[model samples]
Target chain A: MATQIRELIGNHKILPVSMERVRDEDDLYELGMTSFASVQLMLALEEAFDIEFPERMLNRKTFASISAIDRSVSELVSGRA
Target chain B: MNVAVNPAALTTPALERMARVADEVAARYAADVDATGRFPEETFAALKRERLLGCWIPKEYGGEGLSLTEICGLVARLGQACGSSAMIYGMHQIKMSSLIQHSVGSPWHLDYMREAARDQLLLGSATTEGGIGGDLRNSICAVEVVGDRYRLTKQATCISYGRAADAILATCRRNPDAASSDQVMVVCRKGDYTLRETVDWDTMGMRGTRSEGFELVSEGDARQVFVQPFSEIAAQSMLAMAHIIWTATWYGIAADTVVKAQAFVKAEAKKKPGTVPPGALRLAEVSASLQQMKSLLVAGIARYEEALADESLMNTLSFIAELNTIKVSASQLGIAIAQQSLMILGLAGYRNAGPWTIARNYRDLLSAAIMINNDRILGNTSNLLLISKIDVSVA
Candidate 1:
């Protein structure tokens, strides 16, 4: 899940930084992930995981890092399972 | 099952009546509006008198309940008379459509739509901000919540007909803490907001639009904030409608230029008794290009209608790319067709302030490409192209 999240972030091109340099715990916004890019990343994540981020989850904290995204997705997926 | 119908069928007698009123107003004030860089008050008043401002809102909401096709035709006809009026009308419809679709269950928007239907309110959009550099999806200003009320202050790079509009639909970050892209669209009545002009609008064309920059400040009930995400709104309706209707209006400008060109050719041929005017062939070519422009707009409008029926399809990246491409294509074709018309008429079209003159049409059409900047659209399309798996080639 972490690997997939990282891949999606790197490939989404919302951030100016490259994928390899984007650490799991690094703050995506601080690393150049713009609000526009975050939306793109959210869409990509939704498409990849087949889960919609509810309004409550649509905050800066949810997309702060690849690790954060993976954790959120895991929770949603586990809840559904 | 998708049923395709001629978009023109969407027009009704009421729309035709409004178009006539618009035409009369445009005929009287278009030139002066262009010359003075003033809003077309007469044209807007005509629209209001005809109750055409609420054309796109649902009938349940006290509007005409016109479809996108009908709205496109109405805007196109208005464009044929005056670019500024058409653009202003188009922007209003775009905002109205967004509210109708995205704000479905929200009582505030519904009530607002009903009021707009009754009042025929002219709406201004303040999405483009100064520091953002034309990236509409992001904003530097945000909604500041204070108790039950929300305050917004934005340095809008441009607000079309800002001073003239009765209300504004402005965008800002969902909250001060939200990301620049996590924005919400807020509704502000003219009395609710204050504007200080930041820049003057003096341009070569579409001058009547009077798109001046202003610092917009508004404090309103938090309920004015649309509940849906801006991203969802853009993906579903706003972007597509803006592109489609703008395309239709651009087509209208081009069609008018062709009409003038044909008249010029016919007049020249009449003087010569039997010989064809040298420009006759060019007129035919321009006519063909005009047909192509119409096809692009029709295809775009049709696709939008189809997507409108299917919520799932509307949310996809593929649909977004298709709409953007249509915008880029329509804008380019509009400019090209107008340029061709100018060439066909030569000095006659070049002359300012005459029956044979297409100078305003030519200048107005030039604004299409730079309205949102075609290159930016192309770049976004290219990025989407990298991910789009849909086969674009015709069988």
Candidate 2:
């Protein structure tokens, strides 16, 4: 899941850093992930993980970092089951 | 495509009465204000006498508790008589909206709102700085806090009616060492701050706005600063209100141009028995374009009201993109519409002195597109729209 999240992040060009240099716990916003890119990343994550983010989950904190996205996607994917 | 009812009931009678006041007082001084490039003191005095300046403050705050839509209506009427007065009123309301929405935990702000309401104090804004230009999200100046007191000095790029306003809401770095984006809004009351004129405002129009540069120096209690982040305050209230209210005012300028053209066309037709004047057809086309402005602005207001009801959608890229589009479209059309009105009325409209003169309208509408710079708005919106899903809903 972490690898796939990183893959999505890299593919979407959400952050300025290359995936190799980026850590899962790095704050994407601090690393120049703008609100526009974050939303684009959110769209990319939903398609890759096959999970829709609820209104409560649609916020800055939920997508603040790669690990945060991993946590949100995992919870949503499991909750659907 | 859920069409939401307007949250506030701004009736036609109230709007008409307010329009009468605008036409009677604002119109009386508008020419002189524009000629001398000064604030419309007479118009504001009338608005104060009517207690309309504080009409938007919540009734609990000793105000009439008029809704945003009502205030927009009032602003549109004011624009018909004087664009500068309308611009100033919309701006003050923008700052007022900020105060009302952000004063949740701040006792000083709440008390100040009551004071502003009771005294009908005129508020102004200083968002643009010397170095930043039109970029409002960043600020170079920081509030220096020592103990319970803080001091700030900023090269304010443009302050609308700076010398005449009762208070000015200025944005600054959250702390001395905070990042440029980490900012807070501080209320600088009349006696607390000193403004030194830094630049002159001799523009093509909106001359009555007297929007000049000033070096703002102020000291106040630390509580004078808002606890909420300036970014959040801007997104939630400031940007939305500014765009909507300004569009309404721009719409008024366009609408009034159409009215003048219609009158001119009617007079020309009367001069010829049973024959339509050539200008009448142009008037029809101009009125039709004015309808487009009306539809776009009304729908934008509906979308904004709907978004305001939904917390999740407040900061969404979709809503922000739509807001930017509304400004771009309204401003572009405002200039075009005023130009078309001039075309319909010809030399009479072009002249500086006439009942049908739209020279002021043309020059004022010209200020719309460049107020925040449409190119910059489009540049920002282009990025937002890239990730946003296009929802095709006509209803």
Q: Top TM-score: which candidate number? A: 2
- Candidate 1 per-residue lDDT, tens place, B23-138, comes to 67876899999999899988887777677777788889988788788888888888888988888889988988887887787899889989887777887899999988678888
> Taking the tens digit of each residue's C-alpha lDDT, what string does model 2 give over A1-81?
999988888888877667897788976664556666787888888888777776556666688788988899999999989
B1-395 in candidate 2: lDDT tens per residue?
11222223233344765676687989888889999999998788767766777788998998877777788888988899999999998899999999888999989999999998878899999999998998888789999989999899999999999988999999998887766767899998888899999999999999999999999999988888998888789888888888888998898878888999999999988999799999988988988899998777787778777877986677776678788888999999999999899898899999998898988988999999998999999988876555566657676
* Runs with alpha carbons beyond 4 Å of true place in candidate 1: A2-4, A7-81, B1-12, B393-395
Single out the weakest 10-residue window by summed lDDT for candidate 1 chain B.
Answer: B1-10
Instruction: Give the RMSD in angstroms, all C-alphas superposed, for model 2.
Output: 5.9
lDDT of 1 at B27: 67
| CA RMSD of each candidate after superposition | 7.4, 5.9
* Residue pairs with backbone atoms closer than 3 Å in model 2 (clashes): none
lDDT of model number 1: 0.82
Q: Each prediction's Cα lDDT score?
A: 0.82, 0.85
